[model samples]
Each structure stands twice: as C-alpha cells, then as structure tokens.
Target chain A: MTSASKSLTAETLIVQEVAPRDGLQIEPVFVPTEAKIALVDALSAAGFTRIEVSSFVSPKAVPALRDAAEVFAGIARRPGTVYVALVPNLKGAERALAAGADEINLVMSASETHNRANMGMSCEASLEAFGHMVAAARGTRATINATIATAFGCPFEGPQAVEKVEALVARYGDLGVDGVTLADTTGMANPRQVADLVRRTLARVPAERLTLHVHNTRGAGIANVLAAHGAGARRFDAALGGLGGCPFAPGATGNVCTEDLVSLCHEMGLETGLDLAALIGLARGLPALVGHEVPGQVAKAGRPCDLHPAPARKAA
Target chain B: MTSASKSLTAETLIVQEVAPRDGLQIEPVFVPTEAKIALVDALSAAGFTRIEVSSFVSPKAVPALRDAAEVFAGIARRPGTVYVALVPNLKGAERALAAGADEINLVMSASETHNRANMGMSCEASLEAFGHMVAAARGTRATINATIATAFGCPFEGPQAVEKVEALVARYGDLGVDGVTLADTTGMANPRQVADLVRRTLARVPAERLTLHVHNTRGAGIANVLAAHGAGARRFDAALGGLGGCPFAPGATGNVCTEDLVSLCHEMGLETGLDLAALIGLARGLPALVGHEVPGQVAKAGRPCDLHPAPARKAA
Candidate 1:
C-alpha cells in the first residue's frame, strides 16, 4: 500500500439504453419518426448493445409512439445490437413482430386494480395473455421478457404481496421465457423488500433470466434496483431523462434515468459500454425533441465533476 | 406459502436525518429559527436518533441558516438523541460550541476547485483547521466527524480521484476525528463507484468510523447508499424532504430523502428505529416551508407494500 491506493473494488455494470422508447413516451410532442431513428442510430453508434426503440401499443393509446413501426424500420441497425419493443397485448406483440423488433417486452401489474386500470384487464387475463404471447413468439428470433409491474408497491392496490410476484415468476420460469423483469411501477419498493424479492425471484429464476424495471415514482426506483442487484439481478430497464410512468399514475415520474444508471454502473467499475459525454449530448437534445424539460441531471449539468462558473457574470 | 412470506430481509436501517442543516442551506427563504426548532422537536418525537439540527456558517454565505444558535437552543432535546451542527471554520466552531451542539460536523470539498469556491479555502487549510478544532474540542464532550464533500465527483472538477478521497480520510484519521463521511454533494456517484469507494475507504478507515452522506442530485443517491452498505457501511446522512441543493449548481436536487432512505434500509433487514410514516409526514409538510415542492417520492407517494390509500382518498 503505497499510501495512495484506496479503492476497495472495481465492479462493472451494464446499462441498457431506453431513451428511444421510454424517454420519448411522456413527451407532449410526437417526435418525427426520422428523429427517433436518428436518436437510435446515435445511441447505437455510442456503443449501446441494447436499446429499446419503440412500443407496440395502439397508436391512439400512446400517440407519441404512433409511428413506432416507421421509427423502427427507419433506424440503421448495427450488427451486434438488440432492439427491444414494449408490447401491451397480442396486438402489440403482432405489431412488434411486424416492425422487426429484436426483443419483445410484456408487462403485467402485480396489483389487480392497477392491472385493470393500466391495461384495462384483470391480472388473470394479463397472465393468460402473457402465456399466449409467449407461445406465439416461441419460434421467432426475438427474445421475450416479462415485466411484473408494481412488484415493489402500488398506489391503487397498496404494497404488492411477495407471493403474487413469486407466482408470476414461477409462471414465467415455467414458460421457458428468455427473462423476467420486476418493476416498482409506482416506486413503492424499499431496499429490503427489493433485495428479498429479487433474491427469491432469482432463486426461482436464474440471475441471467431476471431484470429489474423500476420507476422513480416514490424515489426508490434506483434503490430498489440496487437491492435487486444485491439480491442478484444483472439486467435492468431504464429510461433516459427518467421519462415514462404508468398512464394510470399521472403524476408519477417515469422509469429510472438511463444516464444516471449508466453513471452508477460505470463508476462502480461495471462494464456498461456507454459514453458519458455522448449520453449527456443525447440527453440534452431530448428536451427539444419532447417539447418539455427532461428530468435527466447529467445532461443539464454535464458529469458531476464538470464544474465551470457561468460566463454571464464574467465580462471583466 | 402465504402472500407476505416472500418479502425478504426484515428489520430497519438506522436513517440518520440531516434535513434541518443540509436541506435548508440552498434555499433563498430564511426559514424562521423557531420553525427549525419545531421541525427538530417533531423529528425527535417522530423517532430520529440522530438529527443534524443546524450549521454554524457565516450568515453572508448561507443566509438560510443564519439562526443556527436559536434553532439549536429552541429544539426540545431528547435524552438519547444526538443533535449535530455543521461548522465551517473557527468562528462557526465557536458558535457551535456555545450552542451546546452534541456533535460538530466539519465539511470540506474533496476537489480543490470546489473547496475554493464553496468554502474559500484549500483542502490543506481545511484539514489544518479540522486538526485545530479537534484539539480545541478535546475537553468538550462532543463527537467530531469530517465529511469529504464531492467525494464521488465534483461540479467544478469532473471525476474525483479515489486517491484524493483516501488522502483526506487518512488526514481525518490522523486528526483523531470520530468518523469520515463520504458526501456525493452533487449526486454524481453510481452504485459501483460507491461500493468500490466504500471498500477502499474501509481499509483505511474502520466501518464504525465511516458514514455516507449522499445527495440524490442525479437520482443515484439512494442506489449509491445501498451500494455502500453492501460494501459494509452503516451510517447514512439524509434530509427529510429531499429538499435544497447548491445554489451555485442550478437543477441539482438536495440530499437523499429520509423517509425513502429509512424505508429502503428497513426493507433490507437493517436496524434503524425510525417510523416510515412519520418521516413521510415531515417530508409532506416541507413544500410550504420552502415555497416549492421538495423532491422526495415516498413522502408524497407512499412506500412499497403500503396498500392503504389515505382515508380521505378512500372516501373520495
């Protein structure tokens, strides 16, 4: 110890870029399909192996992604990339397959009340639909992942029972699905709960088959992800600018911010192959694209360490 | 298994609250000393074992905390509670001593540029001052802690070299201070970085003498805290509402919200005797105190697994 060495470990993490889909969903403006394509192309060039490009919801339900097919078809796909799309039901799955989505992500709220409110279906129906989608996509080249919404907690139903999550995971595990994602859709996850659920989910489902898709609605999204990782999860779903929340939870902020997540993973020595400067540049341009100020801090402030005094006060 | 049987990790994590001092510093409004007192009193009754009540800095520097003395004197101090006051220099230290602060927290930015801009002193000068204060405080029955500000990253300087943090800890150790607090003053820390730093810092500084003070500036604050805990750190510093930020750094949010932090730790099976609901109530009342909506999620949204909508919402 030459008195200068102080870091305990150099652990690396992966960052899945979700700006194209989740980040753009909440914007009032419907970015031109070409703009969405450019964003995807830029992110792909910036070394994102996995990027969620669009959703397969009805054009009217999420008008922001009305040109989802156009956007996906327009993007210049890099050879080694995985392009994921969010699918709400069989229609979404069918549309996503038609749009050439490399991966299909299906979500089911753990709470019945939220499930009805979000997808306009009961939990049982959602699971039944999931089974169908899984079966339909079985022979396709695309991988399938299930997101357990409100895995942490929910406003309408209160905290989700862990048994509900376990049962869902078992179902997904039995389906031989590519993966399962646990979401704190309304941000009600506490660290211990997150750790326990992820741990149990991981034990039932392999770590490689589990991902965490958390929303910062209650500000515990990242904490829950950390807890889940502590309980053994390697994949996660995050949005740039922390955009995209349940349509049912109007005031809830979107998923965890991508740049913030990437920064965390990069700083921890995780190998998230994302360029900080490039992500910041991408994040800064998001406001103009979406027609509102985004919630990403790194883009507005640059990296945490880039401190420069404003030039307005320095005429002398 | 029953529905609740799957939630892992029981018990609560100690959430050391720091809102009275850190949360109020960045706001323009000069919260009344009496209000600070009331807040502290309520917080104590609400069950915070350690509360950072006020800061003994120059009124010209942080006008928001000019009444540190009155706030300290006004709160009804509980027998087992530890009341902490932040002190910047000899004058502030003297005032804190006079105010009967149970503990004195000394803070210095790890980056030289930040140290110069925030405190108008070099890190060396701050360390020397810390040594002098430690010597002067020898007879007083108060604990002393040195917080390395911008330990993860700085606004002025980009990535804080881990070596810089180690040097500061070694110096703090030499000064015989009670603990070392690694503060992500700008919330630039990621989980991997936090874990790595915690691991490295623990080798030089014992876990019992190390504390983590995180700001949720970029939404990674709580995640970083969990990462630190995973690396074996126990003590944490957080604000009630996630209020306040550096005036110099526009758009930066404040410290980690206490309610969310406590809930995260509690769910992780840690032991901290804080009531989650009580902390959330305090967080809910903070918007009016500062004339803006503070950024905490759980206080406004409720915790994970919390199924009860407020009785009013239920009635509605």
Candidate 2:
C-alpha cells in the first residue's frame, strides 16, 4: 500500500523540509503565520515531497509556533506533498489531525529525565500514549510516526544506552506506527555511536520505517548522518537553515542544516533528489525572518567548488 | 634526540597554537608587541605547550605582526613550551633562528596556483628551498616542520588530488622534517574525503609524522579531523577561536577553532592535552586585539551540556 513512496529509484531522494515547525519554534522572533505559509508554499514548489509543517505543543512551551492551526490552513500544499505535524501528546495528536495534518509525529525522549522534562511524561506513559495515538489515528490517511528523542545523548543523562533506545523502537514498531525516528537532540553523539545505534535499530525496524534526525551542535551532525547511512538507514529529518532545537534543552542549537546535509549527500553520489541551489536559496531566506544568523554555513557561503574568478580586475 | 617528541603520542593530540603567527597576520589593526607578548605568555601559562609565537614573513604583507621580533623577545617562555616561528624564506628563517625560536615552520601550498598566490613560489621551488632549510636546521635544536597548504582543497583547483598530497607527504618525509602538516586551505573537505585521504596517506607515511591543519570555512573542519583520526593520522595544527585565513583567498574564514576541536576530541576519549577552558579564555581575549568576534562558538556559548539556571525572578 505504501507503493515505495512513488518510484524513488536509487537516484532519487526526498527532502523533508521542517523549517516552519522546527525552525520557527526555537527561533527568538515569532514568524507571522502568513510568512510561515508563504515559506511552506515556496518550499512545496521547490520539489519537497514531505514538509513537517508545525508542532502541536502548548503555546506556553513553544510560543513561536502558536499559529499552528492558521499556518496549516494557510499553505498552498502541492498534491503529492505529505504535510507532517509534530504531536507531543494525545491532545496534540487530536489537534493536528483536526487541523488537516496529513501525518502526525509523536516524540518522547529515550532518557528518563528528558522524557519527563521535554515531554512531561514518563517513558512508560509516553509508550502507553503512543498506543492511544495509534488507535486515535486509525482508519485515517494521517500516518503516525514515533520519534525516540535523545536516543544518541540526553541533556540530563549523558550517553544513552543503545538497548533502551532499541526497546523504545520495538515498542513503537509493535504499536502499528508507520515509522520511527531516532533523534540526536543534543549534538553529543559521535559517528561511531550513530553507526552503532542505526545499524542495530535497522535490524528490528526496517529502513523504510526508520528516520534519523540529527543536530549539528558539536559539528558532527552531517558526519553522523552519513555514518548512519553507511550503516544502512537512509531516511533523514532536517530543518532548512538548521532551524530547530528543543528550547527546554539549553545550549542545544537548531537541527542539522538541511542544505549542508543535502550538499554533502549529493556530492558523495547519494541521490537525495534535491535541487541543491534551490534548497540553499530557501535557507538564505531564513535568517531575516528569524532575526538571527541561521547556522547553515552553505546558505551564507556557496558550495566549496563554487569559485568565481576575481571578476576581471577592470582597468587594472 | 627525537625520543621526547615521539613520546608525545601522535594519536594523543598536541595542538600547535597558530594564533600568534597565522591568526594575527591578516588583521588591519596593529596589535601592540607588548599585548602580543602578553597573549603568548598567558597561553603558555595556560598549558599550550606548543605555540607559534610569531611570523618571520615580510613585514609589508602583514603589518599587524611586523613586531614579531619584539613580541618574541618580550614573551616569558615557560618551561616545556616550544615557541615556533613561520619563516617564508632563508632571510626569515635566519631571523627566526636568531630570535631563539625553538622550532621553525615553512609552508608551501599543494596547489600550484595557491603556492604562487600565497608564497610567490612554485611547488618545486618551495620543496627545493625547504630541503635547504631542513639541512640548515640540522646543526641546531631548532626543528624544521614543513606545511602543505591546501592539501585537502584549494581555491583555484577545486579538489586536491590525493595522489599529489601523498607524493608531497613522501617528499617531505624524505626531507627529514619533523612533521608534514596537511592543510585544508579552504574548507572544501567533508568527513568521507578526510577519511579516504588520511587512510591512503597513513599507509605510505607514518601517522605520527602527519598533521592536519584545517579551516572552518564550510563547517566540516572538526568533522574532517575526527575522520582523519579514525583513519589513523593524529597530529593537528590549529589556531585558537578559528582565527587565521589565507589573506589572498577571497571570503575564507580563519583556521579550525582550537577549543571546539579540543572539546570534541577530549569528550571522545581521545586525549588532546590542551585545556579547553583555558583555550576559550585566550580566544575570548582575542576580540579586543583583532577588532571583531573571533568565530569560536565555545567562547561565547560554552561547551555542550554547560547549564546555567535562570536567575531567580526578582519579586515583581
């Protein structure tokens, strides 16, 4: 029934744009719903098959994304696009489903402290709720994805045990969820850790149902992503301009800069099916909206091989 | 004679602080010799065992560091600290040796275009002259280290051919230099490229004699370093706060940020004897001298997992 996500041969890759939901929430400036909708519309036209549109967390927690409903209603989404919304709880899942969200994502940290602080629930409670969310979305086209946050490392707990993360994935896999994502919420993970975790998880959860969301906090995000890919997992979740991070987790930066990751992957002969130049342009537009320099280096400095001759030293 | 240097393990990193020579050279402001000496003294006291004290380049090109002699003489060199000087030619080498430099570093770019633009010499000419420099240093304790600039990538040439870099490494290894440092003159390298190059190079050259000098122009500098280490090459050349870039390379940012790199290395259980907090303090002091914020994230944001609770809200 999934139909291979529409003929994604070895040469094709799907870029899931998460700038609106993930990017805006962590940014200091509150991006207007119109601007959010405009950005999403632009991204949709830019050939993004999947775009994570917004999150349904409480306004008190992530105030920048207060207009989740309005932004979801506002985007002129293309027909083939899968609009994903992050749902932190049953209430969030219900809200996202009611707001025309094509897919609902549920995230709970793998570490006990982060699960309680970031998700306001125990790991057991989150797993129990994941079952409820699966039942809630039954019979709807709205796909459900369970994300294991802090799978790599947590703010409270230093290095997460890979077994605990695997257990979380198994529980989610058993709940009939469409997919699972392992997130490096803090950039504390090394490539070896990423390679190890992804390799082990792909054993139980198929590659098609696994996604790795990485943060470039310690500058290892892109390397870790590649390491995971080399370890047999391919699906990735990135925000344009590296725009998202958990605000509750102090010292964390935004998500892995999308354009940078795409550039690296495509250069390495991976078919990400992304228009590199267009994605960079999308990233360039972000810093102005957010009132801070977006951390994506490629967005500011073009690709490495892009060298323009000293522009004909006129009349020298 | 070489036992002490060899005892300093290659896989155990020893960061050669390049801020004095490479970092301050390109600045438009004239930092006083006293302040430069003070910076060196502070760094030396803070456990930077190998610091590039100053450059012996032509004063006309880098007017900021023209007082290299005065700064060198003024510095209070602590025990175990090895002060090195960047020598451009025989004349500069003479001056550096006369100023009691513990070591002398001479560099030539791997790319012909970069070599000519940076040093006004071809690769052949630089290699031959460096052979003479090493022979000259044989009579004294002043060790000679040859640096291959743009070894990973060049501005004029897109990607440096790994064979050319390896050939350069072999030539330098034969020349009896203390070490051969590979530089990513522009941040054009990714982790895969670093791993591939370092792995191939280490098979022919001893990992102990190989050094990597990188820039964060594209944000892959540390990632590349990690890859290089995994491939068995360990020695690294870095500037504090990612200071220093080729003056001629348009839009190039400074070298790889030392504190950030050290933080990553130390956390990974790989030993880099340099103290990160002290390095960060030195980097923070650099903004006043350089007239801008040096691009070291750890200097401003502190390391990952460094938490500061919000001050208790003043009773309204």
Candidate 3:
C-alpha cells in the first residue's frame, strides 16, 4: 500500500529510454542497423533527454548489437539528448568512445554468482576492469555511468544485501563516475525493498546522480519505479514496448515498459518531458521489427483520456 | 517524491476474488457449467475469503454465465468463504437466492450515459428497480452489495464527478445495502482520482463496507488498488488470470488480476488469506476453459522468490 499524503508530491521525473541497447540486446534476432538508428532518431525527436544507444562489446558475446558502431554513427544526434552506450571493459570503452557515445555505461553485477555467470568474471575482477575503463575515458568528452546489475536480486543468488550494493556504489563513486544505476536484473524487486534500497542508496549518492533500471518479469516493475521515485530516485531506465530480457535469468521478461511508465507519470501529473503519443507509435511499430507483439499496454489499451464514441443510437 | 515516514503503515489488506462472475461475464466463449463449478471450488479451497460465483442476469444478456444457477448449486461451499452472485433486478435476485448465494451484487452505472447504455435505463430507473429487488429479498439471508459501475470514469462520458458517486452510495446506504463497490469499469482511473474518490467515499461509508473493482485497461488497475487501499478501502475485486473485459468499452481489458494483486499484497506483507500457488494453478488452467491465454503475469513470470539454479561452471 502507498501513503495518501506521499502520492500528492509533484516533481519532474526523468525517464531515460534504453530500448535501443538494453531492450534489443536480448532479442533472438538482430535488428537491422538502419532500424536501430531510426528508433534512436525517433526517440530523440520525441524529446527524450537521454537514450542508451547500444553496447560496445565483443560481437561474439552479444551478436544482436554487433552493429553498435554503425548504429551510433548513423543516428541523427539531437542537441540536448545524451546518447549512451554500454561498455564491458577497456576495449569496449574504446569502441564506444570511437563510436561517438555521449556517455559510457559500465556494468558490474553486485552478486558474485551473477557477475561470474553474466560477465565471465568475479565481481572484484569486473570492478578492477571498470577501473581501467574509467581511466581510459579520462581525456574524452564522454562521461561514465557505473551500473550495478542485479542490484535488487539475482537469479543465481536470490535477494542481494543492501550493504553489498552500497559498497559497490561507493566504489563507483570513488572511481569518479558521473552517475550510478541500480538495475533489478531479474525483475525480482518488491516496492518495499525498492524503497528501502533506494533511500539508502540516495543517502550515499545524490538523487540526480542515481538511476533505476527495473525489469517487469514479476509484474512489479511499475510499482517498483513508483517506490524508487517516491524514495527520491530521479532518473529511470525504460525500454520501449517492454523489450529485452536477461539471457542468464530463466523466464525473465522485458524491462519496465517506456510508454507504460510515461503514462503512469503523466497520469499522476508528474512531468516526464516525453511525448507519449510518439512513444506509443514507436512501441506499436516494434512488433514488426522484433517479429512479435510487445508487452507494453498503452499502445493496445490507449491512454486513460482516450475516449470511445458512444454506441450508435438503437433503432426506435 | 515519497515521504520516508509514511512507508511504515502496516495493515491487513483484503482481496475479494471476482473471477467466477466478473471474469466470466465478458468472456466470448461460454465456459461449461462443470468447469465453472470446478474453478469456484478450487478458488474456495485456495483460502479466498470471498468468491463471486456468477451473475444472475438474463441468459440472453450474458450467455457466458447462463449456467449461473448450476454453478451456484454445484460448488462445494466453504464455510468461511462467502459466495456472491451479480443480480440485475428482482427476477435475478430471486434466482440467486434460490441458487444459495450468500450475497447479491446489485449493478448500476454512475454515469447516466453508461447506466443507460449498460442497463438500458436511467440511473433513477435502475435505483428504483434495485429498490424493488431489495424489498423482495427482505426476509432472505443473502446480503446486498451495491456496485456502481464506471464510478471512476466512463468510456462514453469522461470522468464521473465525485458528488455523483457520493450521491449514488448515499442512495445505496438509504436502501440498506450491506456493502458498496466502486467499479472502474473501463480502467480509466488514475491513482490520484482513485485516492480522492475513495477517501471521499470512506468518509460517507465504512471502510469494511467498501470495495474497489478495478480494470487494468490502461495498466493502472493494481496502482489504483494500492491508492484506494491507502485511502482506507479494505476490500478489492479481482479476476483470476486477468480474465474479462467490458464489451461496451473498446480495448478495455480484464479486472485487476487476482494472482497479480495477491502477489503484490503478499510481497508487501499484507495478508490476503489466499494461497498464491494454488491461485496461480487455477489461473493457469483458465486458458483451457476460456480458449485463450489469460493476461496474468505471475503464471508467466513466476514469483520473485522463485529462484533458478546457477549456470554450470565454465571451464578455464
């Protein structure tokens, strides 16, 4: 349950679109480079302040995004929108920097089991590697966002400890990363856990410097977002049409849907600075690109304000 | 955006299962009488305190629930679980009474346009008819639950005024109904509106006597339930597997999903007195009965605590 007085808070919520990278990375089929670029352009035109373009990793590791360089090069970069790319190590960081990424999102799982399972290394090794990547970007104009994967819960390790996440974030803060992201890698977060963890994390990091990457695998994605936002988390990562999943986590579904999250924020009178209609259009068009219908609801159900015409007057 | 002090409220939340009636009523295929009875029996065995069996509307009006009598007659009633049925008029009330329903859910719409379109009469006419139905059940052991459909918003008409809902509930109170349900018929409700209206309704009615019937048409059903529950509403109506939709409202989905809502409540440490695993089994079996995939998430995503084994160790 939520607090009545707490629900009345009005503030500008920042939604960072991540469909181009996190959303498409897990797809079985590789999306064409042109389509990925078009999606990024469309998202930028729709007024998103931030968009994760693609991940610069070994093509063998994530073949779906093998065209990361082509995508970043082809997209029509908007003036105010920051384009980000996920970087796994120093080599990936070099590629991301060369591809003109505005920011590099370096990831390290909180749980050792998950870090080993996903990244093929121990948590300490991954952090040490991130240190190299952070140092490599020192002279570049691009900033760095250190993302702690499985920050909420790990499929291999179960619920994660808040102190573990705090320690990892403190390390990232020490590395001088521009921002920190707490990702619910398996969609295993509940509202209470999210609120508690976010509140604790905020005490260590600034609200503007923290972001939430939530998955809807268990249907708590939107609720967790509300809880985290209520706990002073300002930036949220959402995938258009609820695309993407964790290949390592069995039965894990898509990330928190972009249009759905925007709809929730807009309906609650929170400003998102994103055009919902444009986002819905892009979400509706995702099925053809991904070869299936997406999990986003607003495209199918329409907005709350979308009214239907009254039934035709019955014959007298 | 959320006050830290406000998250400490702990209260027992009640979830009223409504799949047998509201869920089946909108289904295009008519579920067999035996299957309906089995579903209700399984739900009763799952520890739900309340289960709506079926509606007593004209068979021609809702052919899917045409076997309401057989369903009500056949279920192995659980002593602690209250079996309810929807009744539209005096005749329907008589049938429900004969079929051994413990409670009769009377239906009327708050919006005049919806009331006329749904019930084929004016608001006053429906209330007057309910008066007759109430009078006819004077000596019966069955209680009455007055359900104001589209209490939050109407697909044909925009938002229904809070005064309209208050006046309707006042009339129900004057008629001596046992409980009142605010039905978000088309899923047009937002959290703020739900909280505002629920708070206003609770001021006029007792919390124990109020129920929230939410639809997930716009993905706000669960959020609305959280909002209303925070505003002092204790009872809620949910359909298993998110089965059901409003035939009158285009693109309207099912009621707040029973499994999903129970998952949220259980995760939040709220008591629902329902076995989630058993309920999920019943929800998963619904696709066979209704000839389509149900919209629930738990059946597909599994619970957050349902963990997977770690991947096999990779050779060095």
Candidate 1 structure quality by residue, lDDT tens digits, B66-183 = 9999998788988778888899987788789889998888999898878877777777888888888887677998888789998988776678899988988888888998877899
**Which residue runs of candidate 2 sit more than 4 Å off their true CA positions?**
A1-15, A245-252, A310-316, B1-11, B78-81, B245-253, B304-316
lDDT of 2 by residue, A128-164 (tens): 9888888989888799888988898776667788888
Best by DockQ: 3
By the TM-score metric, which is better: model 2 or model 3?
3
Query: What is each model's TM-score for chain A?
Result: 0.89, 0.93, 0.94
> i-RMS values of the candidates, in order?
6.3, 6.1, 3.1
Candidate 2, Cα interface RMSD = 6.1
DockQ of 2: 0.26
Count of backbone clashes for each model?
A: 28, 1, 0
Superposed Cα deviation of residue B303, candidate 3 (Å): 1.4
Task: State the fraction of real interface contacts model 3 keeps.
Answer: 0.43
**How many clashes show up in model 2?**
1
Q: Per-residue lDDT tens digits of candidate 2, residues B112-224?
A: 87777777767898888897788778898888878888887776767788889889988987898886677787777777788898888777667666678877776667777
> Deviation in angstroms for B79 in model 1?
2.2
Winner on TM-score between 1 and 3 is 3
Per-model TM values vs. the true structure: 0.85, 0.89, 0.95
Fnat per candidate, as a fraction, reads 0.49, 0.14, 0.43
